[model samples]
Target: MKQAFLTALVCSTICSLGAPLKVKGLRTESATNPIGVSNSPRLSWQLDSEERGNFQRAYEILAATTQEKLDEEKADLWATKKQQGAAKLLVSWQGKPLKKGQKVHWKVRVWDKQDRPSGWSKIATFVVGEQAKLLKPGRISGFESSSEKLNQLYRQSIANLEKRLDAFTEGDVAALGDGSAVHRSARAFLYHFDSVPHLTEWLRLMDSEITKDNFFPIYPGAQTTAPVSSDSGVLVTHPLWWMSGDAQPTRSRWDAYEGHIIAREAQDTLLKGTKWGGIADSENVAAEFIDLCYLGFSCRLILELALPAVQPQKAIRFQVYASRIRKSFERQFVNKDGSLKSKSQTGHVLALRSAVLNPEQKAKVLADLIALVTKNGSKVGPIGAHFLPGVLSLTGNQDLALKSLTSLNAEEQKNYTESGIAEWLMTFVAGIDTIAPGFNQVIISPRIPSNDSLSWVRAYHDSPTGQISVYWKKLSPDSALKAEVMIPTGALSRVILPIRKNQKITESGNEIADAKGVEIIERKDGKVSLITQSGKYSFLIK
Candidate 1:
């Protein structure tokens, strides 16, 4: 009874205001939060009470050209809350059957519990997006035409990487002499980013020198090991194994540091001979690390492009990466009792992390990752090796990935004093941010190789835009085919469509046709066909 009386007293006190009610907020302010011409609309306002009521009470709203007499009474609305989401007073109404580029006006009205109207509000007007001015002929303030085009390009770049494999049998490429590892390094490093011509040119140069007998040592079961500084340049080498030695230089801005990783890995394995698992010094270790790094880079790019949402490769590349990591683990780190022989638990974790994408594989991968954290000082330097697994952990529905990012060391966790993990640590650390940012490292203090020259195999194309991008020049000049096409009147026509000369789209894959982008069509006689250009398939890359 006492509480109720207090509430009544408070309510009574709230009704004794003397100022006249004032309507201050106008929702259609284009000055801020530019109004959008889409399904969702933003509204805002400020309403002050002119007089007090027995209770801090009710309100109504109306919209029309004239604030004067209203013949057709519209629905009355009310608001009890003192404040809400953004503005002091904000309410929104969906524009029904909204016309394109149409401009409309509106206003709000209010009333108290005693049933007295507080007068109508000032007029506010809004204009929808002009159709002819936009890409489409309709109201569309929500979409940015420029941003949409960029999004399309990003999508197209990824599509090209997937449907096609950028790899060429070593036998096809020629040897780049001078042993400086500059051109050779570029030729061998491969990843999703290699879609750029610079990377493909390098891959083709390296690929030419790779004969079938020298490239693959044993196909699937092949070892990741490379002979450190061997006798023959391109003789009968490992047939099944993918050679990753002689790491390359950092190519791009973001790639400078991250690219070091690829360079370190590929340099280590493909240098010359196998010594300490082929990872020798800073430069050499960079090569070994790149071999592992490229796999993650490619997987991330492919997933980001084609299936923006469906990640973790749906269990394809992860398995392949795991097998190689396992081979390395057994070679150097494993103990007789199935326990770690060294304190670098991260190394072991990195070796086994690829399997985490699989629910069944997570248990094993998690055990290794956690063991590294538990047994070690929670340092993430070694964690980098299993970067792909860590990404999978964060993305593969694993609670741990999103759970405060505990795995990030001093360098990784900015809030922490010692968050960063060294790039050349005995055990590599995982990349947390989508794109791994690093230093201008010259492969110094290297723990493992991290770069690759010929690491990716892909195909690409763009439609309506008449463009194509690839990692290697695998297309042959002898291969050229006709592509029916359709060209947008003002747009540039005829794209350099790579095709096997007189080659039909038979079984194996597109001989010369683009693997990704849409074929610009030809609407001749009301029939649609693709417009194309003869691609220069052969290269004298030396």
Candidate 2:
């Protein structure tokens, strides 16, 4: 009896000392049991351990066509016996090439620092298909307008963006071209369609490449590497924070690098570019022009949104630096006639979109842009074209923006490998925009064309929280308008309706003042603006 007790105690102690780790958050290609995954998708998971100072020493993965096979340890598909490393993300599948629409069940286990093995993780299943590779539009987000040409343009733009998606690994997604512009444009497309999982994963991959000096590589996930002189991966953090409504990612990055380091790096880049007469070492005037705009814009964002909370002094310094760059931009690029010295469509568009230009200068630049487009059409390249429509609309020329949009020929539209068209259609034409990050607040002010070119517009965006949609029809030119809007739960919207001469606005046949879940903020600038909570609303103006 004494010997048995001693043996039992020893066994219990050994079991207790085993690694207290379990695998969780299993994902294939950054999605949980995602459908339409690649034939050879990458697997990833997180380790949960109650014990401190425990880290993964090695891992093993088992994949099979059926759960029973995995349960029985058959591993018909593939079995990575034990990969002796600490890689917990984007581990490639090696067993066999999965067929289209094939379902795969996978599980993983890991050994700890002391070589104590963890139990098997929960099984995750992914469906194999070619479609999984593309960043397609969400089911809840779509666009439709009276003009078929405009509708087709939106669809084609999405397709173009998808074609530009190049995977570094079997499951990793990155933009095809090098430079900040391509990746930034791709990210905007993903955000607009609410491709959260893909975007999050892509950002993670980009973040992993951020050097200790806070420099993001010009070409992510590529063998050839160089530091990006302009705002690339870092600048996209602002939109990601807003779209995800999660500040942790942004906060953590800044924390890792610290605000002062980031500010200093930016300042150095600016100084280096001063020699080249721009913010980056580019001989092309248009490239330099866009780089200057991006750098100044990124610095301004950091100064306003990121640094003040943690490093107030750094924020002040950043503001001064940004101000100097802005002044220098105008001095070097802007001609006496208010047109850019380069006389390129790209230069003008970048100038207009950037905060570097004041209102008067922007007006002059806008006039020049309109004239250039009017005379030559949209001669802007892929990068500059991304911001063209939005800039035009923000300058209060939505009509001109729409005209430029619909006038694009097939070949010209095909060259636009960015999300600009889709973004413009959703934000300007349908007029559904997020006032706060993650669609906690939105603005719905559809720019119904004053002319009869477009009779109606309908669109929706599935935000991280829920779906927000808007539809409007012109009952008659300058006579009556009908609009229907859906605000997701837990979100607020500010609706702006254009008030015609002596027109009265009513909701559900009742005065706007008496409508439920609606609050009249004001009537200003020939428009009625009202705030509303989550629900569907219909308005008529006659």
Candidate 3:
């Protein structure tokens, strides 16, 4: 709950300027070396620099269970070979068994853009505590106890925004206060969780603040409309407007330019002989078009989740609207080869993420998306970067997703981006996601790919029902993939464990025999699925 500043360490004097390259600001959070958690914590560091555009090209980290091991220049726990990427923060930990309450000592060194190597960072330490200690205040088993801890994070995030709801006045809406649409926090809660505590009230307030014109002003004052031209549309209030802060024109300028693009192309075939005007502008027409498409995508995701529970009748209306926009988006943006007209990373990723592509088009689009990133040397701008991991996982490319998410540089500091990547590590790649909001029912399906850089994972999610934990290991190609799961009381889980071809699964050194609340669903295509209820399970796939 309390935040601490990251500690910086001075490196050996190796730079041309004769100053030591300082690795500064190393505060570990939930994703990094968590104070008390089941899963392995990640590590991140920042370089203190005065040079213009200085950045890290690669880095290596070493960790030990004790200071003695670390001082001996040995990685008793783990040592990362130099990893090539700009990402210096939230690097996943791959080390020996880290038990609860064991202190971790670690240090890092980096290679700069000029190919100069920095000296090892000063040793830093973090006390390990149980997630249950933080959440339930009791001694409990591993990752399962951490689920409540993770859930509390979401709750806290929502509570923080709930207190600020009143500050978003009509003027704040027009100005796009805090770089997002006023309803961003509310929408985030709606999208991720099953429901919020005060759903109806939250929606009502959001609706009242965002008017039909969708223009967000810094200060609404007494005027109902933004001072800018009426041509402004949803672009004026897009949540991601701040991402393009580097764009030469301000929000108003981009909105006006987008309006011009729509009006000018109203008669084009892509425009369908209709004048659909008003949107956000970007570096290119395709980027601008994708921005509009993203708006429709956001609406679709929201309505898809919110409608059935709250507004049943409005379902058809929202679906129709979302469908029409999606079709326009696909027709205009998605090319025949499954590439975006813009060929931009964000455009392609959104095409997949926003559900603009049909099921049949997903494969091609995915391939193109991967190529786009690889072709560009794995560098994506801010807006599209955050979506990459989820997009990859949803497309059955967990291996690639993990690779992409960890591939980072010092430049990335976005809160949402970091958290999204962390979620992937904790849930999908680590093999745990709540099928039900509040994690009443979970799907424990670990996707430890053959080429995975990680050897093992231990993670937990505290659910409404109880704590769910999973510890998995794929020691080697010849060895069986082992898994241990702890299911909470009153909760049910669909466990889909991975297996090699021609391999069978065993539990307790024997074939997995069905028991009460444990039914073998099926075993085919290198996977075994089981319907499990409320118990601890250990299995080996060989």
Q: Relative to the true structure, how large is the alpha-carbon lDDT of every model?
A: 0.30, 0.68, 0.52
lDDT by residue (432-492, candidate 2, tens digit) is 8888765768899887777777889988886654567899999965669999998864457
For every model shown, the clashing-pair count is: 121, 0, 23
Cα lDDT of model 2 overall?
Answer: 0.68
Candidate 3, residue 82: Cα displacement in angstroms equals 62
Worst 10 residues of 1 by lDDT: 439-448
Among these predictions, the greatest lDDT belongs to 2
Clashes of 1: 121
Task: lDDT winner between 1 and 2, please give it.
Answer: 2
Candidate 1 per-residue C-alpha lDDT over 182-297 given as tens digits, one digit per residue, 9 for 90 to 100:
11122112212222222323333333343333432111222432322211122111100111111121111112222322333454443221333344423123344333423333
Report each candidate's C-alpha RMSD, comma-separated, in the order given.
28.6, 14.9, 21.7
Model 3 stretches with alpha carbons more than 4 Å out: 1-208, 212-287, 413-419, 514-516
Misplaced by over 4 Å in model 1 are 1-196, 209-278, 281-338, 353-365, 374-378, 382-399, 402-542
